[model samples]
Target chain A: MIRHPHLRLGALLLTACLLTSAAPLAAHAVGGSDAAFVAATRGPAPGPFLYLGAKHMVTGLDHLLFLLGVIFFLWRARDILIYVTLFSLGHSLTLLLGVGLGIGLNSWLVDAAIGLSVVYKAFDNLSGFPALGLPRPDPKLAVLGFGLVHGAGLATRIIDLGLNPDGMIANLLAFNVGVELGQATALALVLGPLLLWRRHPSFLRFAGAANFAMMTAGFVLIGQNLAGYWLTTGAG
Target chain B: MTEAIQPMSARRMAWLLGGATALAALITLGAVLPAEFNRDPLGIGKATGIAALWAPDEVRIDPAAGQQPAASAQGGPIRTLEIAIPLGPGGDPAGKDQLEYKVRLPRGGAMLYSWQAEGAKVADDFYAEFHGHTLAEHGKMTVAEYRKVSETANSGALTAPFAGIHGWYFLNTSERPVTVHLKVTGFFDPVAPGAPGNEAGLTARVGSF
Candidate 1:
């Protein structure tokens, strides 16, 4: 649909830029001063926890990529809201439950699964499953499932931070609220460019390339996490 | 809008998926594995000098090769040590009564120690300095003082900030002779007995190193 060479090049460049920007934020694991702060914090410190939660969501490129894939083809506002609310519900449930229940899984494995979610979403965007004769599950259910996995990953990181038990529920609720706010902010920013791009004739053509890039990033994430598991745990 | 889009051919889809997979493999094997984990599956990381990105050879002075800072938490068995340091002769100068004792500890290693000086007329008569230091280049050392007090008794714990020697220095300024009693228990390796600065012949007991 994009007949002009310059416009096609511009679209390609935009995708490339998006990906490269995501490279530094490859994993959503907290670290450095933020990790120190989390570990040091005790009791109900809602304000800092809220800020940290928002920061995590904004900087989480993996979450953002999956979100991009989820909304790439969605045209109706109501449909978008429905899918997002489902995802948020799933994410929030596991985030609270996993930490509450003290469920400790291998961090690397959880991250790998999160990576798989990205791959799955990108593949779904490309319509790869039905084409391969695989019975495609409901997209809404799939998004919810992936959201659960994402929350598990978040739980793993938070647990690793060694959060004090006192007033943890209040802090967790604040963090969850912050995460939702960050998601909304990110969605607004992404949707603006996406809406403008969709109005152009080239959007459909560029969509495939974009999903392919997301898939590649997912694969890279999987490899990195698996490598981490192998190196740290001495088990494949 | 979704209804108007055409499904791509499986063959073309396969090519794209395969291409993306190959690119990911290339990046992981060539760049990320080496840069992050120092694993060079394809040897590109080694060839391109990226293996050092994870840990530069010169800076990381690990007793065991290839062991990371995270792995340093796997400390050996906990040990205990108690030693008595006798003061110098009554006519000796202020510096003559000073003595030092130290123990080796890996980064993240921890220890609890308490010391008390006997025969000291007042708290100010005894001086103690608790510190840690690592040997730097050219026979120099980098030291960090944890505490300094002119007290007859002190008790505390230390989680080592780095792999180094950590301990105390005691000085008796009183004319009366003083004998310092020290007790230490932790996951640490006591410095070799009778070594320099270990004139008190400090040795650990209660665990096999």
Candidate 2:
């Protein structure tokens, strides 16, 4: 097959981006001292909040890869809006409820589930299970469900801080808003380049390679989180 | 006319998938390898050492009024006493250390007090208070007015100006250990010679103010 040169380059760049970014995400989650430093310095300061929010979105390889898969096949602006809104709503609701109600869960477990979400999306993109003769569940519901788990994972660190109840509700809402803004910013940065690349014929040829990269990233996330679960809780 | 391009064969697709999977597995295994072999708890020895400093060899609590019978120094109404414990030595293992002074309250009277560390950043920055206890069964006082306060009076990363101030207070109920555990995590070097860090131990006693 004759490949579009631009699409091939975009695919290669995407793979490199995913692999390089995935390392730090997995490394810190598995207990790097730097992670502890970041945790300790987190406070109500607007500057720290913004920095943390941006870092969180950028470092989150699973979230970014999932967004890539979601938008890959979408040609219309409206579809992107619909899917991102559904995900945003799902995440916002759980982030508020989980922290406000003090509903704590094992962070490692939640993160592992998040890793599975990445895998699920990649498989869906590849039409893997359907090819094997299994019924595929609705993608929208799956996105929303995974979105809740992702938000819960974000809440774990805040819960560990034992934040003062004074202004906690307000602060949490602010943080959630910041998270959405950061997500929107990342989407623009990533998908703008992606949409342009899709105009090239190579997009079709290299789509599978992109999906393979996403799947690899998902597996890496799973392995890291599972290891953390074992080390911290002695659970799988 | 544009020629239609051929799709990848199923075998090629499988190879791509398999290779990606194997690569991911290897990366993950590599990530986990360091943690698996290095099983030492991150701060276990340090924490144990800190805990050990407060393990009571002996203790005494004197009443300020001197009206009541002298309670056993082992554990009683803690007004004033002498504490001998090792302080920090300059090193990398040192963190932003803190000393926690804990006082168990007597049946009716709960003690309320604060302290300042005389010569150390870790010590001078120490602060605590206790209150609110009514005697329960067995004449054992449960802490009712328990308030934990921290030093917010000073600033600067390299210097602790309030180093030699009082450290902690308590209202003793049971004759258990009125323990003070100082966890040394941070250090400061004086610009002048014969500065503190000259002594390796901290001496601070809790008393009613």
True contacts kept of each: 0.43, 0.26
What stretches of model 2 exceed 4 Å from their correct place?
A1-7, A27-51, A232-236, B1-19, B35-209
DockQ in order = 0.19, 0.11
Please name the candidate that would achieve the greatest TM-score relative to the true structure.
1
Q: Weakest 10 consecutive residues, lDDT, candidate 1 chain A?
A: A18-27
Q: Which residue runs does candidate 1 get wrong by more than 4 Å?
A: A1-6, A18-26, A233-236, B1-5, B46-52, B56-209
lDDT of 1 at A56: 82
Q: Pick the candidate with the highest lDDT.
A: 1
Write down the TM-score for model 2: 0.54
Model 1 agreement with the true structure over B125-196: per-residue lDDT tens digits: 888989877744332355667889999899998877777888998888788889989888989887887864
Q: How displaced is residue B58 in candidate 2, in Å?
A: 32
